[model samples]
Target: MTRKLGLAGVFLISLAVMNVFADRSDKEVVKRVNSIEVVALDSVEGYEKKYRIPDENLNDLFAEKIDSLLNSWYIQNVFEMPSGGGMQDSLPVVSIPDSVYIDRLQAIDSYVDLSFNKTVKNFIQLYTQRRRDQVEMMLGLANFYFPIFEEALDKYDMPMELKYMAIIESALNPTARSRANAVGLWQFMYGTGKMLGLEIGTFVDERRDPVKSTDAAARYLRDLYKIYKNWHLVIAAYNCGPGNVNKAIRRSGGARDYWSIYYRLPRETRGYVPAFIAAAYVMNNYKEHNLQVRYPDFPIVTDTIMINSYLHFDQVSAMANIPVEALEALNPQYRMNIIPAKKDKHYALKIPIESVAEFIDNEDAIYAFKRDEFFPNNEIINPKSSNSHHVSNISGKDKVLYTVKSGDNLGYISEWFHVRVSDLRYWNNISRNLIRVGQKLAIYVPQGQADFFASVNRMNFAEKQAYKKKTPVTKTTSASTQTSADGKYVYYTVRRGDNLWSIARKFPGVSNNDIMRWNNIRNANKIQVGQKLKIQSRS
Candidate 1:
């Protein structure tokens, strides 16, 4: 079985390998990429999860996140994205030569190789020509995010130019989530995020935490750099993983650089490095292309306050005179708009710089304001005292017919029914959001929850909003919480793997001692699953 390869055999093998890579050049990069059949990677095993770009033309994400923002003095005043409501981008286009791009890229001081190529040129045009609106939006966000990224990069001794990677990954949107569930500015999937020490749970997802996620991203890039010793390869590995990059290296016959092994990588990742180059080019020279950078009108200064007790956005809003929207915008990490802090464990709450002293002075009132209503464990009520009725688990098309109240809009109705606004409109065959006071709308909910949703039509506006506050509890919230005429207590049905202390933490200012005393439980550990405990909520 052992036969030495002759010189002729070795020559033929080397020639075949060279010919294969010769065809995998920029000749097909721009014009023929669409025709390249999508590669199936099911066969390659044990590779880490990918957080690749969803599209090279990343205009839609900026538009969608920008449009979804509600009335927050922080969001509305901070980021003013184009309304696209008949107003055109008024900037005149300025076309530039490829040599100009090459020279400009060289001019920017960077340790990473910013070499020019046709693939890079194609991507640069994609940003400058086609996605200029998005470029402007990202340019604005970069003003807010770049300094955070630079600090992390500097701390890790990574190249300063790596900050542009955020533009490619998330358009500098801190809350940007990818199709692969990769969230935050750096597009880190849950697995990679948790690997990099990001806190992910029902309450807080630090992947959307700008500073923490940027730090995580910088550390990850540094580790990848240790492996490849090349920034371009490190960038490619960040899109896919080191496994894919290593696979590409093997298939490319030991080629080390990006372009040499580029064809052997995933199709999405093939454009990744080039897209980074494009991102860097557009971010730096967007002004030269006549693109206007609409920076945020508000100041970016913020101060972090330590939360040692559980806190709700409403409480802070009430006591500190800060809008809940501003609190949420500043800290998108809190999924339920609640800071789930405890005596032992703490989380930081970011407030606008001006409100730092104000918040600290009124911190006690903020924590205690309606603490019993938000956190049910604070005061216990007798189960027998509550007029809570049994909710039957029913099947079939469970529909709730809701009569629109005077102030009800499609957005409010959809949110009340836990359905999409589009779903509400589609179900009722209405084109616009317009609805009269007596307009009947059918809301289809999960098969088991017909009676619960139907009761919304009878509730007053204040009660409906009170019901809305309980929506963050997911399946654990009782259907009868807001349905009772008195509405004295919110019932919490304990789930498996639950304990008194853990249950108490869900509500701010509630402790296990409070839960035990309120529930009248002799022992804290004696509570069973499916046991409903009453926590007081005022009508």
Candidate 2:
């Protein structure tokens, strides 16, 4: 029975070999021995090469979105709101004494130097009284973003206080874009974002992906700490870049303290450290500042699923009864609202915890639902179809140029223009909806309507109000249109559940395009039920 025993031994070894192969996480294997597989010698090397940051130069997009966002945070938290109401209604403003501030500073258990000074005190005022409402709002959002940041920081063994740095960088706005083209909550520029392994492409900018970017930021911070060996100097280096920090050090005769090189740093960088300390203090003791600590309404529980097939957001929305807007908000990294997963390469799709089962139950239907409507012919939408931001020619029709105003995003703009959000990005070369207030964008419309749009845009706020005054009755025909008192334009009073897209469908030859063009409207979603809409009268 020696031959039988030999066969049994071989079978047992084969099972052991299968178990060994199952334990490995790498993608490819070369050969199998008795109870182990020989991994390809270059497999690890190939992975490092593939995942390493590529050496390439990219042009930066200049915009004031980030500056305006930061400035608003300053105004909201450092200046009193116009309404006079504050968190400290019963308490005297600026009541904190120097001793109290000093004690609080001394008590802070942080690796970063928490020094009490005029700069820090000024920021404290900004956070406590002047911008209490803004501080409250930041606190609300912090409930959602801070945990993600903390998790990454913990993974890298970095100090948790470093989470406050994102506050100074992006005010917790995941899609925040800076004037220097730095992007995301961390405000990473192209060179740094790319080097940190953030994928920046036509469809996905992982820098805007909250989870991924925070991990990258944590890794970068750990690397910076390794260089400076001091959190304060590391913070300065982060803001001004290593080169600028190095120069500042030389200018200060090789000083390591942030305060010593503060004057030599960039003007913005000078305020950065103080802001970080203020943010940390404000976040920790918000109740003392009379700020409300409300939890954010954002989905706290989410599940990420690996998707290996091409899918459009509409499919998931339609099959799972989730709003497309909700999906877009959750997955902002997908620039075009299209997840370009291929059979060979997989992408992660995150969904709310409650809806995970729904998504899974209807997975097949979601994949096949109206596939053509979302992505036609499997071609990725080109982000650079238009060279200029103004005057797009769609279907050979002339287009209008609309300047983005504050409080505008792709959703509302799409609703306002009766154009798909995808079309807006394709026309403006915009990869994300993080638009600046002053940026101009192209809107295609029927010919000869461009001049009308200019007149609409030129109208003063008072004139626009007068133009769109609502009436009591809803009309079903063009005869229902009301001429403004000045007789220069017509108005339609919106009804319940009305939107630019739905309203545009009601009037013949009066698309959302014409309404937005004639009214200087950009965000269609901003139209409320009782709001009035200006339209060109068919009568």
**TM-score of every candidate:** 0.60, 0.58
lDDT (C-alpha) at residue 539 in model 2: 21
lDDT at position 492, candidate 2: 77
State, as a TM-score between 0 and 1, how close model 2 is to the true structure: 0.58
> Model 1: residues >4 Å from true position, as ranges?
1-78, 81-94, 297-299, 378-539
For candidate 2, give the lDDT. 0.62
**Model 2: CA > 4 A from native:** 1-67, 70-93, 294-297, 382-539
Point out the worst 10-residue segment of candidate 1 by lDDT.
Answer: 1-10
lDDT of 2 by residue, 1-539 (tens): 00011111221111111111244444643334332212233343553353221111110111123225434422232222323232432234566775666666656677776754556666777667655545565675676578899999999998999999988887777777766788888888887787778899988899889899999888877877766676877887778777677677666666566765667877667777777887788787777756764322224456888888888776786687554545665787888878889989889988766678888888988888866545557655543352333333487666878787766677656644445676788888888677898898887755554543444344433232222211111244444457789886677778754555445534433444456656676443466666678876532
The whole-model lDDT of each prediction reads: 0.64, 0.62
Model 2 lDDT-worst window of ten: 1-10
Best by TM-score: 1
Report the C-alpha displacement of residue 61, candidate 2, in angstroms: 20
Tens-digit lDDT string for candidate 1 (1-539): 01111212222122222322234334232222222212122221221122121233433433344333222223343443233322243344456665577668867777887755556666777667656655665676676678888999999998999998887676666676666678887888877777788999878899989889989888888877766677888888888777777778777687776766766887767777777877887888887887766444332456889999878887897688664545776788887777888889999988867678888888788888867656657542332233443332234657788998888898778656656566677678887677888988877777766755666777776455434322222344444233335665567788765565445434433334445656887544478888977666321
